[model samples]
Target: MSDRNPGMELDLEWVSRVRVNTQAVLKRAQQIQGRKLVKKQWEAAWLLRAVTCIDLTTLAGDDTPSNVHRLCLKATQPVRYDLLKELDMHDKGITTAAVCVYPSRVADAVKFLKAANSSLAVASVATGFPAGQTPLETRLEEVRLAVQDGAREIDIVINRTLALSAQWEALYQEIRQCREACGDAHMKTILAVGELGPFTTVYKASLVAMMAGSDFIKTSTGKETTNATYPVAVVMARAIRDYFLRTGHKVGFKPAGGIRTAKDSLVWLTLMKEELGDEWAEPHLFRLGASTLLADIERQIYHHVTGRYAAYQELPLA
Candidate 1:
């Protein structure tokens, strides 16, 4: 919709040749995480950037309108006002990039944001999120329904079966259809890397998703037994780099699931800056699909500004 990264035709041959060196990926991940920490003044700035890139999320079995409203309010003002003021960032109008919810809750998020007079985007996970085992038509229809319900961003899962079987063309076509169904809303294709076997498969799936017109390539759904890890992120980031080299399009990358703690946010932001440069560090190009991560970030920021640890209640429920 924003015309940021219009997808291109699937090049199966190019995709087939994709390979990843597991050892190199693991070593790089370690190096990135072990790199000198951003200290004092600069650390706070990096955390603030992380706040902007968060897709503040809530997806659970018992998610209600009440909780969803609370989540929306958190998304509207992720860090407390006093914390922002202490950090001298209050006038920056800081907010999370978007609010991610299940398909059923998309309208609730939209309505809440409207009532609050906030322009935050709403992202809904569809197409049988987490597993993606539904019929193809059902999946596409799910996307359409979410769009009609006022979701500005659609986070659809890729059929892991297709990727596991090396069915690159089939997977590409499926994602292409989902993109069409998304219409103007930005489409984020979740690779569910944990189910896809190895780093090579993750790399290939990332390429195929980009080729098929995914506005963003997400690492996991947060429902898998094993969710996002640094090794997996390194592979996906390299894949994004390769995609940019072959095609002029810049596809965004999101590492969802198990990303808690302010340190986690800093590591991810550093990864983006190192792999994709400064541009990819922005919310439009990178997102941390997290709910609890926000609380940790708030706690860290409060500590950084005030030099005192925040009580649990001091941070908002995210």
Candidate 2:
């Protein structure tokens, strides 16, 4: 009887030990790296190509009536007539994609887009816009308004109040609500990672945005004095790659603000590709926020495609 009791106790202990070991193994297996090194490098190359083609310009032109009017008119023209003339003369080039304009004029801009040759996308700033402090209802309504106005994409600023306060649940809720509000439109959630303060905060915010149904996690709104940066994007991309590995969901990344020249775009694109891989190379996964980048990219592509030196200033202003 004594021997049997001892044997039973040993068996129970063994079972408990085995169970703990099994759980550890399972957990280890579940942790996967989202991006492979080779694929990461390939993505960097494509992103470079995409960024190089962006032409960035400020919505508000210099202090001149004609320039200001030109800016306003281009916001709704079929093509800048001046720009077309430049293209006709082979003096400038058109970018890989179209410019991103304000929500108020999206429909008019889309109306004038030469669909056959150039692609156009309207970028609407949503959810109380630059401040992002309004009631949820007001935020949703803003998104609706932009969509009705023919905006193909919506760029939303994250609730900085919630983020800064460490009210993650509220932050997540805001993103979810905003996503639902967007309907069919792709949602780009700006962490305003810069406003988030540190790398840890940025990383956490990145995770929050992705988990809450953000299609693309954007760096910042140009409204901020300091916009996107290298490390900010790097950390965001790393978080995205990790999230995909865990949930099988691929979230895109966009580094807006201050991306001026083709070279600037290329650097961010390369970083994205190298960090996230080919899955991030598409417009669905990547984008640059700039008004003037398109011209420089046009010049590069023109030189490559047509074998010539084309200056951006020579391109049509539309």
Candidate 3:
């Protein structure tokens, strides 16, 4: 689990008064993605930083112990050894921040990491992930079960119905219960921004999750029709900034789903740098919930070092 924030109590008045400027957010998103373009060595460095912040994830119905073990091994050494040697990063002990899997696979991930004598954290999506339509008690029990199975991070999906209905108190109480069930594990609240309607709702949901003691506010669960857009990210990042300013606590931001390319990772890194300053760019504060993204990053890094693009067969399966 990442560091805990010990979030403040729910303030319905503050949440109700929160507002977002859609035009301003869209303009900022456009400028951020178009203006800054790092090339060559600087781009490679930024990609490397992004690699460290990735929560290498494998959440599928077909997930098994064998596949989860492979993912753990890949998480231990994300980039190839020869490539790292060429870049002089071989001795840096580069690895993904954590391995995110479904709640049922938490034990498998833990066992694999332990057998390898590695310290990689295992993150499990609990509390009826993606849709979060299950009963509250059942959801909380799911969180407890995942933690009992050795998961250090619990990714819980918020009840979008409550947020959409503007039931701030209910949403806050539900998330608080889930956080309590997490025990010592870090709780990442997925707002499922794609289904949360406008940017205003996204901003408000971000605040509500942070106020309810979420260690991280994630954008999506990778099951929505659309996920992790730049404008939504800007709103959520600013909300995190606002929360930090008012309460003296820094909440983390995660942009998951549809983030597949190395360039996409660079854009998110730039967003964190420009919106919340450089402190949010670190792995402890930022995480990219992605599966296939690592392969593209490895390909880019290989090209950066060897001046030759690597074929798909050359990179390890993510």
lDDT of 1: 0.91
- After best superposition, candidate 1 residue 174: deviation in angstroms? 0.4
- Top candidate when judged by lDDT against the true structure: 3
Backbone steric clashes in candidate 1, count = 0
What is the per-residue lDDT of model 1 for residues 45-73, given as tens digits with 9 covering 90 to 100? 99989999999999999999999999999
Off by over 4 Å in 2: 1-48, 51-99, 114-119, 301-312
Report residue 45 deviation for candidate 3 (angstroms).
1.2
Q: Can you give the lDDT of residue 151 in candidate 2?
A: 70
Better of 1 and 2 by TM-score: 1
Candidate 2 lDDT score at position 156: 88
What is candidate 2's lDDT per residue for 1-318, written digit by digit as tens? 000000001122221222123343234323222222233334334433464233232344233434433433443332334433534522333233334555565565555444423355556777876778888888888888888887767888898988777677777787887777777777888887667776667777777777778877888887787788776676677778767776677787778787766556656655666678865755567777776665565455445444586665655563
lDDT of 3 by residue, 186-260 (tens): 988999999989888988999999999999999999999989999999999999999999998889989999999
- C-alpha RMSD of each candidate structure in angstroms: 1.1, 13.6, 1.0
List the global CA lDDT of all models.
0.91, 0.61, 0.93
TM-score of each: 0.98, 0.70, 0.98
Better of 1 and 2 by lDDT: 1
